[model samples]
Structures are given as structure tokens and as C-alpha cells.
Target: MTPHQAEQVSFDNTELDKFAAYRSDGATPDAPDILDLSNNELMLPPLPAVAESLHRSGLRVNLYPDPAARFLKANLARHFGAEPAETVVGPGSGGVLQQLLLVLAGRGDEVLYAWPGFDAYPLLVAVTGATGVPVPLTATGEHDLPELLGRVTSRTRAVILCSPHNPTGRRIPRDTLREFLAALPPRVAAIVDQAYMEFDEEEDPHDLGLIREYPNVVLLRTFSKAYGLAGLRVGYAFASAEIALRARKTVIPFSVTHSGEQAAVTSLAQGEELARRLAHVRRLRADLHADLGAQGLTPIPSSANFVWLPLGGESDRFAEAALRAGVLVRSYSGDGVRISVGTEEAHRRVLIAAKEFLSV
Candidate 1:
């Protein structure tokens, strides 16, 4: 075998395959092309105000950005009711997560989290040379807080809690979260990844209140979803001032581009517009679930902007069928296909394709 082939064998082959496969082949209509639900990016672009700010910033090619991202952090803190020193902005929340893994984990350290959750947690922990301990979720696709708490050990450095979780789209309720945190070991860091919190229909979807009381809890938020700033890649984290400092050290200065920061800050000031967009997506997601049910495909209840269809290997078949009908959806084998709640047109296309797939 070639050296390159040997290197490829060292990683999770499933991830390698998923990463390598494109939803569509440019020249072929046989490949999926109509809808892209694979990467979880919001279908809409940022508001004109945000777009205008980026356009006016021009090229800051020669200057180093504010190393501490003070102004941007301050704006975010003010919006979230947190202190400026308690928050740190990163190019994207994913990048921030990478930094957290680097700083808090090392060889022989075990990182605890729930499985069928974010695909990145284990991958990131492994990259940092730490062991990953995944506590399985309940049958309803909810994180089992008791199981997770039981697995925490002296060697466990951190845990990642993904609410409005990926793939499954179920959320961990506030009362459940409080119980879990109360049970967690003080030394173990708990990272709350609220990537899809904006789309949550539930009241009080976040746990910012816990940050005020638990120095160990770090809350992660991003602009990629409801804010529609995915292209600019902006996100931030909030923790106790001391923990925030350690997390900040993992990322180098100017890592967050000036344009991205400006766009995010502008979006924050734009206010209720984002909440309006999320409400629309939430409504559409519910409508799509009913549509899928009408066609005999069970779509798991979702709190995020997408729905999960439980179909194992048939997920690949479902995705292929979707492509045949000129629509694309995200595939998860151990569970099913995840269709993004996009335009009304896209949602209708998925419904038609799903009906056709089920009939056959």
C-alpha cells in the first residue's frame, strides 16, 4: 500500500468517506442538486445592514485586528447580559471548540459527552490525544443526564453538551440540565454547544443563568444559524473570567477576521429580525414533519431548523432517491436522513420526493 493509503487508514473511515463524498457531481443530473441539507448552514444570507458593513470595511490587509477582540466581545456581552471579560470571540464556534479541546485535554485524559450528537466532539478529542467517553442518549434521542454524570471520572477533563442537538434535533430541557450540572464533578469542564438554540420554539432555550453560578460551565454560541452569517464564520463563548482567559490562550491573535467580527456585531444590533426568521423556520419545520408523516416516513421531533428521519443504511437509499428527484438531504446511517428546513419551495420538493420514495 502507498504511504498516503496507510495514513488514511488511521482515521475513522466513515468520516473520511463522508468528507470525501460530494452531494452532487457537477456534470450529472443523477446526483443530488436541488437542496443542500448536509452541512447545517442557514439557507438565508445576512441582513443588508450586516452586508453593507462588511462591504464598507474594505480590505484590512495591512493591519492586525484587535488582539483581544474587546469591542466585539463587549457588544456580545451586552447583548447576552454577561461581562466583557467573560466572553471570547472566535472565527467560528467550531474553531472555539477546537481550542477548548486543545487547552483542556491531553494524553490519558477522558472527555465525556453524549453520542449520536455532534460528530466533531470525538474527532476533536482524539486530535488532542485525549480519550472520548460517550454516554448514550435515551431512546427518544435525549441526552441521559444520569448516565453522563455517572461516567465522570477524576481523569475526565471536560464534557460537551450539545442542545437542540445535531442530527437528532432534540433538546435537553432546563430542569434536566440543572440536575446534570449539579451532579457533575467540580473539576470537570462542561461545554454547552448551543449551535441551534435560535431555532428552539421553547421558552428560555439557553442556560446563560448557569454561567453566573457555575464557573466550570462554558456556553458556546454562533451566528451561523438564525443570524444567517454562516459565510462570515463568527461565534463566541462565555465562561467565568478565569476560564475565558485560558480558553482565549488556545487561539492566536487576529484569528477572527475583522470583516466577520463587524458582520456579527452588526447582526447583534439588528435585534428582533433574527428571532422573526427563526420563528418562520420553526413553523416550516413543523409543517415539514407533518408532511413527512403523511408519507409514512417518521421524522423525529426537532427543535432545530431541520428534521431527522430514522432509516439506517436506507438513509443512503433515501438520499439517493432525493437526488433522483432533484433534492438533497443530510444522511446519518445509524439513524436516518436529516432534511433542512429551507425555502417553502425546497420543503415541498422534499415532501414530493419523500412520498415517491415511500410508495416504492
Candidate 2:
């Protein structure tokens, strides 16, 4: 075969194109109009102070960002009580995940993660030429530990755990995570992706205590969620100093820009105010859950900023109606619809749209 033919053949089987294929079709305008709920981004930008800082810090456009992303890493460490040396920041949580996968797993290896979890997990595994072992959640929509434990093999190099899992919004309890970590072979690393931890009111959040005990455990977080910095694209991971240092080395230098780093640090510094804003989102999420239930739509109990509506037969239809209503909600044909909790007015608009769909 000619070189061109081989290149064409290689592109055809590229697994990174999973969701990449779905990106072409943009959301319809008539949809829910509630794009505000996307990954915890507020319709409004940060407060004036943050905005002004961005404005004045102008045109460092000529210079590259700090290679280590020191300021953002320091702020995240201070905010989360992690050791500064144990933290590393990336362009976003997705970037951090990609870095982790690249560093830990390679071709012929196995990666264990929960199913109906993050859409990116399986795709990333496939791109790496690694086997993606997806253990489905239980009926209640919680990650099933026994089944996951059963899937582990000597080839399993790592496990990815997302608490307050995307799509489902069900968090893996701390004790459960500890148990899973303990059961895994010492050679295998467990990556805890806490993208929605800020929305969780759980008394004892997913334990970072394990990091001190297990050199293989890594905690991943993102400013994209509660910090309302999704557009700025900053995320981080915490692990033992050794693992964190290794992960940092794999990161492309200056992957995070100047604005992204500053925004993340500013967001962390606005802690109390940010917490209040997150609480509002939680309240709205609760209200949306109740409103949808009243509309005869069964929604999964959400601990995140978004709620899941299990539209067994009409998932697509309902999503279509939402789009028609000028609101944008995520729809998975075989799964359910994940709606972000927007402002109160926006939430009411979505409820109206959802009600109309249910009536039909």
C-alpha cells in the first residue's frame, strides 16, 4: 500500500474521534436557552475585580506562561489543604485526565473506569490503544464496586473514579473509594476526578487522606465546575509528591496560559463568595429535581449543579422540545437527559419547556 493509503487507514481507526464526531451538529436554537448550566459556568462572568484584573494585565501576549504554573498550583493547594508539592495544574480537567492516562497507561495496558461516567474516559483509553474496562453502575445509578473490582487484571494499570459522576450526579462515597483503592494492586494507580465536589454537601467528601497512605492515588479537580471558570480552562490533580512530579513532567510546557492561571488563583481567593454562589446552584438543582418529578419526569437525585432526567422512552423527544424552547440540555439517546441548573428565571423557563414536552 502507498504511504497515503496507510495514513488514511490510520485515521479511520483513531478512537479520539468518538465525541469529536458529535461536535459538528451544534445545538438547535429553539432548545432550552439554558446554556447557563454548562459545566457550572454562570451566565455572568466573574465580579468586577476579576474582570478589571484581566483588563489591566494586558498584552503579556508576547510572553509565555510560567512553565510550572506555580501560582495556580499554590492557590489550589492552599484552598484544598493539599501539599503545594503534590499539586499540578493543567489547561482543564480533561487535559489533566489526558496527561494522567498518557503517563500511566500505554498500548496493551488496561484501564478500569465506571460506565455511563464521563464520556471522555473511554475515548481517551481507546486513543491510547489501551483496553477500556467499563463496569456499569447499579440500578440506583451509583458506581458498582464489586463489579469494578472483579474487572481488575494484572494488566490493569490504572482506575479512573469520578465522584458526583457526570450524567448521573451520584457521588462515590469516601469509604467505598478507600475500599476500592485498598483492593487494587499497589502497582496500579487510582485517579479520583472530583470535578463536581464543590456541589456535594457530603459531610465527609471523597477522602484525600488516602493520598498520604497510598502513593498510587491521585485526586483530580477543576475550576471549570464551582469556580465558574470553565471558559478559562484550569484544572488540577493532587497526589504524592513523586506522582505529581511525574505527571507534571508529562504536561506540555506552558499548556496553561497567563489568563487561565490568574483566573484560577483569583477564583480560589474568592472562596466564601464562590461558596455562596455554589449554594445557589445547589438550591436551584434541588428545585429543578422536584419540579421535574412533579411533571412526571423521574430525575436522578443530583448532588451536582446539573440534574439528570431519566426519560426512558422519550429522551430524544424531550431533548428536542427543550431545544425548541431555546434551552440547551444534553441528551443521550440510550441514557437520560442531563440539564444544568440555571438562574431562577432560566430554571423556570426550562420547567415550562419540560412541562410542555411531558404534556405531549
Q: For each predicted model, how many residue pairs clash, with residues at least 3 apart or on different chains? A: 0, 11
Worst 10 residues of 1 by lDDT: 19-28
Which number leads on TM-score? 2
What tens digits encode model 1's per-residue C-alpha lDDT throughout 233-276?
A: 78899888988888889886787877887888889877677777
For candidate 2, which ten residues in a row score worst on lDDT? 30-39
**Candidate 1: clashing pairs of residues:** none
| Cα-lDDT of candidate 1 | 0.80
Cα lDDT, model 2, residue 240: 86
Task: Please provide, for model 2 over 1-360, each residue's C-alpha lDDT reduced to its tens digit, 9 standing for 90 to 100.
Answer: 988877753464344554464234645444343344434456556756567656655568689889888988887787778888888788788888888888888878999988777777887777677778888877777888788888889899998888888878898887777888888888998998889888989933335687888899988888787877777788899888988877888788888988888877776667678768877788788888998888777899978878987775677787777766666777767777788878776677677778889787
What lDDT would each prediction earn against the true structure? 0.80, 0.78
